[model samples]
Target: MIRTRFAPSPNGLLHLGHAYAAIVAHDLARQHGGEFLLRIEDIDAARSRTELAEAMIEDLRWLGLHWDGPVVWQSTRLGSYGAAADRLRAMGLLYPCRCTRADIAAAATDHGPDGLIYPGTCRGRDVDPAGAAWRLDMARAVEIAGPLVWEDELAGPQHATPEIFGDIVLLRKEAPASYHLAATLDDAADGITLVTRGADLFAASHVHRLLQALLDLPVPRWHHHGLIVEGDGRKLAKRRGSPSLADMRRDGADGRALADALRHALLPAGLSLTTGIGWTT
Candidate 1:
């Protein structure tokens, strides 16, 4: 049986972008007689709000999406993430990182697909783990995992090049696990057969694919859909002041009607959809 999930962080409200993503995941599962699941990515305790998560659930419900099982929260799966991190540490695939964003920007001499690549300043440092994050030794990890590949339902076959991310963080000092580690494990734990998300995160699949190989986790096919954008082609975002589904619900909009319209590529005025990444507003 096929399984897909819509995992949203509870740090903010759900916008049209989220609705479209959810619809894609939910409809894909329903059309294939598969299961659709919901997950609250609340690992960032400082930003995660219960009231926001409650409202997020209400928004999805109002948008005519109902998952097959109870919602999963990242906060509850810390133990599993810890175990994975321990395994990587034992394999000498992880190192303590004490470099902060500012420190990295100053030391970084190269750039990668993800952004300003870390210069590996803390790679050989005897950093105190008390306040340090855990970063994957990308070179060592790739060597062990060897040449690998993954497939996307839409984009087809892809060569796994997680090195583009350049020694990404696996465990953060403030959080139990980074998105790459937590989401990958969660999908496997929940038996998600297919991962559906936005094209904006398409590059992230490479990292996730590598994590799967390193952790000996199941590799699932991915379908990276497009993002809902604005009149200026900026990807819809909460920080961009995009219209939220919650606001529409509060105004008594028809949920099912909105969903059907979304299915047909109908969007609110001054907004559009784009399969490619758009600039920030």
Candidate 2:
């Protein structure tokens, strides 16, 4: 059975872009006769709001996407992530670096596709464990692991070597679990066989795959769908508030119209979509 997940961080309101991403994941599972599961990526407690989570659930249901299993919350799984980090630490794949934002900005002299590329200034530098930031030692990781390759249904095959994201922060100085660590841990634990989300995360997939290798977990299939662009060509997100489905509801957009717009916006070229296509939201 193909198991897939829609893990959204409840940091803000669900926008049209989020709906598009959700629909793609849910519909793919239904089309494949697989299970669709929901996982709350609320590890960043400071930004994740309970109200937003409730609103997201209501929005997803309103959009007609039903998921199986009780939702998994990332905040509740710190021990698991910590254990995984510990395993990497034991293998000497992790190191303690007390680099702050200022330190990184000052040290990061090169720019890459993902913006300021880490210069690995603290790669082999020694620091006090109590005062240092915890970073994944990518140099050691590459020596232990080789190149990682994964296929995307839409974007085709993707490959990455450790040289891209050198020794990223697994745990921040404040000891909070970063997005890469939490996402990898949850995806592996949930038995997700497929992951469908927006194309913006395409580059980050490499980082996630690296984590999978480091943790010895099964890698899942990836499908990065096209993003929903706003009139200004900027990607729609909660911060932008591109008139959410709830806003549409207030304006009497109804489920059918919302579905129609989403279908027109997301369907691949040459594919025909109609109201009878069984769209839930």
Candidate 3:
């Protein structure tokens, strides 16, 4: 059976981009008669507000997207991520790096879609534990495993060689689990067979695929839908003044309008302003 999830970061309001993702995942699961799951990716507690997290759930439901089972919160699942990191550590795929953001920016030779890839300054450096941050050893990762492949629905096939996102951080300097690690563990644990999210996360799928190989989990099929762009041709973001679903609902806009807007965003070539697609409230 097909199983999927909508893992929102809970860092911002559920905007048009979020609604499109939720609707796509919900529709995909329903079309296949699969289980739809919800996972709160609240690893960044500093930015993940309780109100925003609650709003995410409420907004998703208001969009008529019903999920199965209780929601999974990443903050509470740190131990599992830690254990996975430990497993990678034992396999010699992990090492401690004391490199800061400045250190990486200075060491960058070329940049990819994920920005200045880590320079591996501390690749084989000894870990002081108190001073070192952990980074995945890319050279070792490449030697141990070849390029990670992801079968995408929209973009077709893609791969992320270790050379791209070199030795990514499974654990940070603060030692909290990063999104890449947490997402891989949780998606597999939730048995998510398919993943539908924004095309902006297209590179992220590669990162997640690498994690899947490292963790020995089954990789899920990916469908990276298009983004909701603004008049300036920029993707929608909270910083960009995209209206939140909560704000829209407060202004008497319902899920139908949200769905219509999402559809318009996706298929702009064949746009139609219909609000009666399959929802009422």
Best by TM-score: 1
- Pick the winner on TM-score between candidates 1 and 2: 1
lDDT of 1 by residue, 90-187 (tens): 99989999888999999898888778998888897888888789999999999999999998887889999899889999999998899999999999
| Candidate 2 wrong stretches, greater than 4 Å | 266-281
lDDT of all the models against the reference? Answer: 0.90, 0.76, 0.77
lDDT for position 197 in model 2: 75
TM-score of each: 0.96, 0.88, 0.89
- Backbone clash pairs for candidate 2 read 63-281, 97-133, 98-132, 98-133
Steric collisions counted per model: 0, 4, 0
**Which residues of candidate 3, in runs, are more than 4 Å off?**
264-281
lDDT of 3: 0.77
lDDT of 2 by residue, 1-281 (tens): 78888888887787777787788888888888999999998877678899889888888887778998898887889899889888988998888876667877888977654667777776777767886668887777876778779777766687766457777888876546787888888888999899887777777788888888878899999877776665455676667555666676556656655765685665333322222111222
Residue 85, candidate 2: Cα error in Å is 0.6
Return the top candidate by lDDT.
1
Tell me the lDDT of model 1 at 184. 96
Using lDDT as the measure, name the better of candidate 1 and candidate 2. Answer: 1
